[model samples]
Target: MLKYYNELLYFAQKLVGDKEKAKDIIQETYSKVLETQNKREIKNQRAYLYKVAKNVAVDEAIQNQKLQTAVYEESEHLTQKHEQPEEIAIKQNQEELFMQIVNKLPKRAREAFILYTIDEYSRKEIGKIMDITSNAVEKLIKRATLKIEEELAKKGF
Candidate 1:
């Protein structure tokens, strides 16, 4: 267990992108693995540790997203107002155009961009989910952003 601490910490940091949060995740992973071990016989401790760390990181991300959404909803509610008909129409058209532009992106780039921006996933997480390297994920996202910007510019947006 002590021998795997540094490796697990590095893995967790890559997943969560924060040293302190990664440490917390490692602590949770160790706790869960220990609790589970006591309840039953264990096999493949290394894989189990990684699986637990990934689960903890994902759980933390979901909890954080929920908290952020709650705060955003509250603030939006406070600032809510009825939009004029023209304003509503303009917003709808802009959204439609944005979707069209996004759809024009190459498949991998589009997927990476949506995962990073719309789904709020970190590059490392996206890479894991997409079965790509983090550098590849970064490149795909940048490519998508540049294409979207060029399209918008052409459209006079």
Candidate 2:
């Protein structure tokens, strides 16, 4: 174990992306290996140690990912109204410009684009809502996007 200390540390560090966490994983792996009841039946001690290290590292990574996801969700829940004034202003400007371009679209194209983009409607759902076929929804959305792109280009956007 002493011979493989640095090597195991390097392996765990590579797997976990953190030195302190890797060290803890290696220590736990060593403890688990030392407590094994069938030590004599092991064919290769070094290989067994590496396998244990990998398992511990994988478990640690999974736990860390769950913890990070939970923390992110909690923070998002706690900060529902945390938008900065500058960000709000920029978003409003972009939304206003998008609405201006969208209003200039042909009536059917405008409806399709709004349903698809702003309302987050699927093409089939837009078809149901717009009383048109799904293929027509696709074509209208595509034409609206192209017209918006051309308008933005004309405005040096």
List TM-scores for all candidates, in order. 0.48, 0.43
Q: Can you write out model 1's per-residue Cα lDDT over 78-132, one digit (the tens) per residue? A: 4333343223435666788899999989999999999999999999999999999
Q: Which portions of model 2 miss their true places by more than 4 Å? A: 1-88
Per-residue lDDT tens digits for candidate 2, residues 1-81, read 567778788878866678999999999988988888346554345656777887897687677676566456647654333
Poorly placed runs, candidate 1 (over 4 Å)? 1-82
The TM-score leader among the candidates is 1
lDDT of 2: 0.78
Each prediction's whole-model lDDT (CA):
0.82, 0.78
**Lowest-lDDT window of 10 residues in candidate 1?**
78-87
